[model samples]
Target: MMDEPNPPVWPDSVIIVHDTEDADTMKQKLEPTQDSWNAEHNTFTCDYHFSDRRYAVLFTPGIYRNVDLEVGYYVQVAGLGVTPNHVQFKGDGKGPHVPSLNRHIHKNSGTCLDTFWRSGENFSCANDMVWAVSQASPLRRVHCQKDLYLHDKDAYASGGHIANAVVDGHTHFGGQQQYLSRNVHFGKGASGGAWSMVYVGCGDNAPPNSATNTTITKTRVRVEKPYIAVYDDDKTKFQLRIPLVNDGTTDNLPQVTGDNEESRDFRHVKVATASESTRAIQKALDEGKDVVLTPGIYYLDQSLDVHKDNQVVLGLGLATLVSPVGSPCIRVAPGTAGVRIAGVMLEAPAVDPAKRKSTESHWSLLEYGCEGQTQADDPKNPGALFDIFCRVGGGGDADKRHWINIDSMVRIHSSHVIGDNLWLWRADHAELNPGESPNCPNVSPVFYQTEKDEYNVDTGIVVTGDNVTIYGLAVEHTSKHQTIWKGENGAVYFYQCEFPYDVDTDFGKAGYRGYFIGNSVKAHSLNSPGIYSNFRNATVQVETAIQHPDSPEIEVVNPFTVHLDNNGIIASVINGRGPAAQKQGVPSRV
Candidate 1:
């Protein structure tokens, strides 16, 4: 019999920072050129906000000194060990000195309002930390020695989700508008928030639902996101480990499927770059090779099919997949089980209708299964999508004629799928081209013109699958219902949504709901959902934020709605259960 060959080495972009490295060695590896290596002067940096590069920095299991890390756009930093305790960061003497996220350039000078697309996982920090970020960012399985601030100095921020983590000190929300903390151990509990703050399956010390906070003591079922870990004895070997589903257990430690015994070897993993075509990548997936997409943008003419069970598609440094020809970026086949997609962004690029293609717009950015549904493989072993962001706009130039629109951002046709930390946005605002906006210069106008309704998406998510579970989901600026669920046995832990800013009074009154569960559904669980509306285009009053039949099997908890500006009003939180949110800063809860 022939011996199996070793896989190819990793690319130059995947840098493994060792514990013994000094400043010079780090700079030599990270900063090939000053122009290319965009970072702030202090610590390990990647501060270029608009740069196109992607990077993944992995730290070996050990201690480190004088290394204050600062994460920036398109960067992912993680420990190579099995758990958070495998990698420890020594403090800078005064306080806990964990790696700080990229500083925000808007509002307050040094806040983290605009920090996005960076992640920290499976690591321990010695001192106090600040992670002020918005959507598309996640912190998982991290141990913080001191208090964690979600925002800096009360600056306006809209962050994000924290899961399966331990914070020894208080987790302060500060000026953050909304956030979710799931299955976490908050040592001193939590405080602060401008609009909504949710806690689900948290420690006993966590606060309960009140006038401002929304809390759920337990969840029905949850499967933590799968991750990559290195061997303790041989760090060269890597494996993708899928966790076991939790039966309402709130423990911070993740339970793997087989005590870490069952995992896929790195030799079978394919490291793909942006230069590779979609066909080549699809072929690799079809051949049962787990793929790692390095930091770059991939343009796909058709969907990248995920057909194999237990296959992993991991993206480092915000790997982006764009569909420019009105097709889905990725599609999972029917009855596939244990397929994981993590740390990836799916985008629908703008295309002119006259560009020799079908006049129809994009159907969806991502589809879990084909249009014809099938029974899921195993109820306990479902497919997973974590830290995935989907967008319908923001890719094309500022020309209105070329803007591409999508009907829906995500469509789930497979049963028993799990998702965490998803931000599906229709892009209320996008970066404008130089000639489009003279006054604002780089930023887009507040909203698109009313006549350009063809550029906006209709819905953010549509679920036709049964037994689906989602934790920490956000959908924004969709013209119709932000989320529509027509399946049974569905569970949503935390959902945040904003109505279309361009909707008029007549449309807002009769057009949409923030969350719509079809009357045919029998069993569902939804908790801590927040819906808001600004309606900058016209004064509008919505009838309800959520609409669902009052069935005994359906459970709704801590649903709330907010009117962000004076132009909009939410008449009831859900099914006429609460008072209207008429005031700008007030929230109506049920």
Candidate 2:
């Protein structure tokens, strides 16, 4: 056996299991009388619950056989390995078969328990290990040779976040608001009953709220057959973006898509300057051709309207589209479908920081589906955005810095708009020289620092359209809500957000949340499997993480007092021991 790396210094609450002897020793430490009793078989079970206590179970690298482990509130089960496959759990049991000695049969309905099973290196399991766990309990980095069921066969499960793992058999999620990220592969099974890599809400009496909100990001499928096959319900609030390529090569297995070129095709355009570039782009769009902008700075006096369907506007090598004062850079007309905007940087007109008291508002750099009434029929082909970067500041002069004070960086009114790797930034640090005409003006450096809130942009993204999906969205330092989703059935994969560090009092003492889901509408979902935020001011830290109720699996690191509002209920507090809290970081407030 490979020597195990030095174990992490766990908190006093964690239980370390090194061998079979350690498992027995720890069982006594938790209260032997509390052990589960199986009256049907008249046998004593090994399932132990710490009740209100919060703890973690760390297993060293080894092969553990027939160990039926169930955790309770604030309990974490982790293996010490470089990847998940290092620690192996083997048994002869299959399906819902639990060892007679120490097994806890999973129930379908009850108060959801918050538990976690993860690995540092690689973890693998031979039998169907996790047969009974709720949405609160997550299993991570476990390669299962046999099927690894999440919830009971008959009952509907709730919420969980599974990351970086693979299962040879079908992996079922009979719950709602579940997130699967990073290389989760499902094996290709027989073509008969439920032959899908990932199964969502597949129970007969599944809850009405179950299986509606699910997100799969950067995941892969090993089978040649169709990856996800939904049954018994409409996969309405679902998002599948940036999937790893499944090339038909035995050696390659699951090949990751190389550069942006491999993902889509585009017609390359090299322009000497900004003049007539708009007309040239319009002509190309009119012909139903995708466009690729070569490396250059292009200025747009008027918005480049995308009226044609299935058009792609891709940029190469930091290609920039700059808008003049009070003009939007790009606009996607109504009824346009399959429109893609990628690898481009958008800049709004700069404003003098010295004029901080002005009530004038700036325009958004990009607007999509903002025209006409909402379509009742779902869009046949949705638009997509990949690696789009946007900035608001340009000019120099710390005191008189040039900035963009727009209502929002991006506005979406269309349905089924998917985004992968989007960054909407308000430049905190200046770049261009002062008094440089349009880009910069002579201003005092002190004014820039003292009037930081005055120079900041209002919001990052405002969505009014339905079925919009975003994968990696990072919006930093906006004055109001950094991202506001007024639309219904929206999905987000991973969001990295930070509140403005420089804001003093323009947005009240509570500051603002990184994202806000409108309370007027229901059925909007956000699966921020990995979300990180930090605030500068102490008073500004206490803001809601998200407004919607169905949002699940938000991992916040080193955050100042923040609240997670799921639907209308206050689901959890940042760094709290509730279902949303991380087990490793700062101690839970609960």
Best by TM-score: 1
Query: Model 2, 90-144: lDDT tens per residue?
Result: 6652311222222233331322222221111135678754534422233444577
Q: After superposition, how far is residue 413 of candidate 2 from its true place, in Å?
A: 0.8
Question: Which candidate has the highest lDDT of all?
Answer: 1
Q: What is the model-wide C-alpha lDDT for candidate 2?
A: 0.47
What's the distance in Å from true for residue 531, model 2?
A: 6.5
Regions of model 2 farther than 4 Å from truth: 1-277, 352-362, 375-379, 394-399, 432-451, 505-511, 529-538, 541-543, 549-590
Q: Pick out the ten consecutive residues of candidate 2 with the lowest summed lDDT.
A: 223-232
RMSD of 2: 19.7
590, model 2: CA deviation in Å? 9.4
lDDT of 1 by residue, 1-590 (tens): 12112333666667787777886796576443122222453332223444566777888778866565556666777887777877887757321122333222333234354456778787888877777677777888888878888776755577588888888999888878889888888899899886778887786878867866778777666767667777746466677666766666554343312353356666677778888888888888988988888778898867888899888898887889986566788888888998888889888777655673566554788889876667565876788889989876653456652366668989888888888889997766555455564333343232233323745778889999998889888998887889999988999987899887767887675758999999899889997789988787677888889999879999988788888874868888888779998878677787
User: Looking at candidate 2, what is the lDDT of residue 436?
Assistant: 32
